[model samples]
Target: MSSPVKQTLKWAQKLLPACDGDLNHAKRQLVWLKEKIISDRPGGAIDDKLSEQEQTQLEKYINQRVFDHKPLQYILGTQPFCDLDIVTRPPILIPRWETEEWTYKVIQLMHQHLDKSRPLRILDICTGSGCIALALAKHLPKDSAQIIGLDISNKAISLANHNLNIHKLSIRNTVEFREKDVFNLDLKEPVDMIVSNPPYITHDEYNSLDPDVKEWEDPRALVADEQGTRIHKRIIQVAKHCRPYNNDLPRLIMEVGGTHQIKPLTEEMQINGLKDIEVWKDLADKDRVIVAH
Candidate 1:
């Protein structure tokens, strides 16, 4: 008498014992099985009858994938970021709550600096699924904010565009996605602020990450050289390039890997002559975000 999803969940519990170490894998399997079975319902309706044979086949396929360590977000192709549903895939890093926290801080700072009458232009570097840019566009004053999201990966750009359309936000036009390396970017117009959650995990530490992450998430998006601040250093250097063109210095808000990264990053900021450098801690009291003028 149980629904198909309920039956699938029960089956997952039984078959996932061998994979007991990976609870995320087991949970993903359950969700995938439910979605697959529901999608196959007659007339695309969940109320439509599902034959016993159809349910059995779906459970088999889902169990196999789950045991293999594939991520649930990769299977579902969507993740939630600050109330926005974002499209995701293999090459992009799944949106994390820490990134959302830093993004909100950037928006708050933007409100203080940008004038009420003029439109505020913001740039998000290393944009994975366009979550930061899209979230800002959705929350900021519509009449005075414009956002642009840039990623080096074409796949990431496409996925971000897809999320923008799915949300049905008119900010799509204002929030453009492009495949451009943060190191080589040449900005024509001066942006009010530039924010990024660039790769800050050291290569050594990256190699030691949990299997679920190293196996499923994009490695490039997670790992970096020079103790994980290589990309962050590049972003700081590039911001200087924009200073000559725009009379006003742009503020930078970056999410760091850990408190250890603060020293190296602060030195980089000093070498680049950036002002007002400070570290912002997350709710956990760890220095997670770096803000500078």
Candidate 2:
């Protein structure tokens, strides 16, 4: 009978091979499983002295699934995104660190340019887990900003609402999660900014996604037509048309696929009359965010 921590560590080491040597991911899965068992206790504290039956049940529940490459975030049912606990479930694309990094950048940029006194409305398209929208609401001035998270999946919208309630118990800000396809959006009120992390994986590329992604995530939320550039192009065109008649167009910021995507996406935005188009790289130095004014 090994201590629970030691037992979990041992299992994590064995899981490392299946995770492509990702020790952190393996350990995170173990921790998530451990937390679930101890969740009812105050502070969600862990006890190393798990009874033999408890240890057996825990191992049986998670070990094989982890070995088969299910994403830890989905298994845990939550992912941390820019200080928000984004609830993740099946078919909703898990929030990535790259998106988190650039989302913060967008927030910082907005603070620098937008008038703090004026109320700001921002639309989040393809807001899978409401990670980006909720993060903005939590960080920005509660009284000055209105955020809407739009998604095509009803399940995602439900989960987003649950996540908002969990993470924003004392909600001082306005954040709405709605089921709306980005392809067919009609905004009654003009927004000051628009942001998204839309699907950009091409059909061919989708076949190459990791088993964890291919098996567990939603294809509609992962694949796009035309070499993964379709949704991005549509968003640019739609944003152009949805611009407020009396004011300058809403500032657009989006997460793109890669360095190759930056040129083509920026070009599409330029064709749609968007100005001040800029490409930003993630921490890995890979082109990740495209900003257009």
Candidate 3:
């Protein structure tokens, strides 16, 4: 007989078409569902066999994924980011791997460069689910950083706060979530670093995206004006108010939409007297993040 993991996946694939379906996505949903069901059970161990009840839960999740067209992350109610499982819901962007990749690296960079004696303040504009901010809080030196996540969506801000609370017992760093528009906000306290994974998809591109994405993820987190550079440019403009970073520390780090956004956004960064700039590639080798001080 196949292992329980295999049987569980086989069952889901039959319902969701995994053999030659949405490829990794279809497979991942099945795998994650199995893992989620197992981990959520009281006294359950990873090596333990799945119970009949677990299989029933998996079937329900499969129906949600296959018939209801809900994204797997949302169905799971969380997405792993760095070392934290960020709670996810509708209208708040689920954490993406690209964001997680850069975020993990950013935490490492902070450890290597930030002054340990002074309290670090980080502002995450368009914070969405607070994944980046929470990840930073979890990984950064204990009591070393104060993180604030800002979003215009009340739902997004509330969800961000919820994620922070979920990990509150373990995370010691100061973190807050506020509903504020980036375009019109006065900084009561200047931040040492500004990071964002703002909306960068154009209207045309957004319309072309899979209906599942449009239905589940928040459009305001994915679509931006000015051909996907509007929010990026605004972040660059806002970088001036942040405390400058030296010794290879980046004061401003923002996710962008590949090469098309690099030139114009970097030019705007330079216009703001930011002389040092670096473009970091995501795992896919796409220019995914721009760093400037």
Candidate 4:
């Protein structure tokens, strides 16, 4: 036990340079890697420790890839969003802290304004990892809200379903995962709300992303044409097709790029006939989510 711990500590020391000399960050990655190796074992026993050979293999694994600045969520295959442990994998955008922050705020607003007696239907477009959808399930009334998480990647849908089941969210039955291109989405009924953290990174910005993201994460899930507002425009255009429920305008909440996205996105929402448009900033006070009816 001490041998493996000592070995990983040495490995962490060697990896510290790649973590910007942050010893804590390097140690956290070591711990995460150990957890991953153990969880892959039968029954996932917590007391199970690695053998000398296994520790050597783990060291090689970290040295080869993860310490080279790969996103830690992809390395560990999970991320915490709200109170749920969401499954994370490649080709699906990992849940961002900013997205989680705004999602909780949206849920709070829904609780205050939405009719609790009636069922609430929510559509989550580009629902990578299903973090936003599952977060809503964990928070909203399990008996009332029906959430659908749509992503173009089948892998993302599968991972989202895995997250939904693993977390044991009581609302899992009502939370559905589907593979659909948001650009061509056509709903049969108008949902109470539509929320998305779609691909909003501009092409130029995508080119300049960190190698950790550029090499490991999915480009299709990140970059958009036309200054990152192309998909945002499509989302707004499709809003005209959805019918409003309960004599109230259907709610639209979407995560945007930055302050640069505010003016054009708001104008696009208004042109698409959405009303009551507003911008919500993230923790950094950067404009992040656009809320409209």
Better of 1 and 2 by lDDT: 2
Ten contiguous residues with the weakest lDDT in model 2: 241-250
For candidate 2, the per-residue lDDT at 195 reads: 91
lDDT of 3 by residue, 137-242 (tens): 9888899999999999999988988888789987879999999998888887978889999999989899888756888887888999999999888877788888
TM-score of candidate 3 against the unseen true structure? 0.88
Q: Write the per-residue lDDT of candidate 1 for residues 165-235, one digit (tens) a residue.
A: 87755453268888999878887887767789998898889878866578878888898888899999998
TM-score of 4: 0.88
Q: Please say which candidate is ahead in lDDT: 2 or 4.
A: 4
| TM-score attained by model 2 | 0.89
lDDT by residue (1-293, candidate 4, tens digit) is 35756766787887786577898988887787777878776666676568666677677767755456667787777888988878788767888899999988977876676675677888898998999998888887656688889999888889988988887645533788999998778878667778899899998898788887888788988988889989888888776565565545347889999989889988988888888888888889898988888
Each candidate's number of clashing pairs is 0, 0, 0, 0
Over the stretch 1-293, how does candidate 2's per-residue lDDT look in tens digits?
A: 67656777897886676567798987876666667666645555567555566667666646656566767776666788888778889888899999999888877865665565566778889998888988888877556678899999998899888888887764547999999987778777777678999999888888888888999899989999878889889888767754432233247888888877877887898898888787889999998888787
Candidate 2: C-alpha RMSD after superposition: 2.8
Each prediction's Cα lDDT score?
0.76, 0.79, 0.84, 0.80
Q: What is the C-alpha local distance difference test score of candidate 4? A: 0.80
Clashing pairs in 2: none
lDDT of 3: 0.84
Ranking according to lDDT, highest score first: 3, 4, 2, 1
Task: Give the runs in model 2 whose Cα sits over 4 Å from its true position.
Answer: 1-9, 22-28, 40-45, 242-250
CA RMSD of all predictions: 3.8, 2.8, 3.0, 2.8
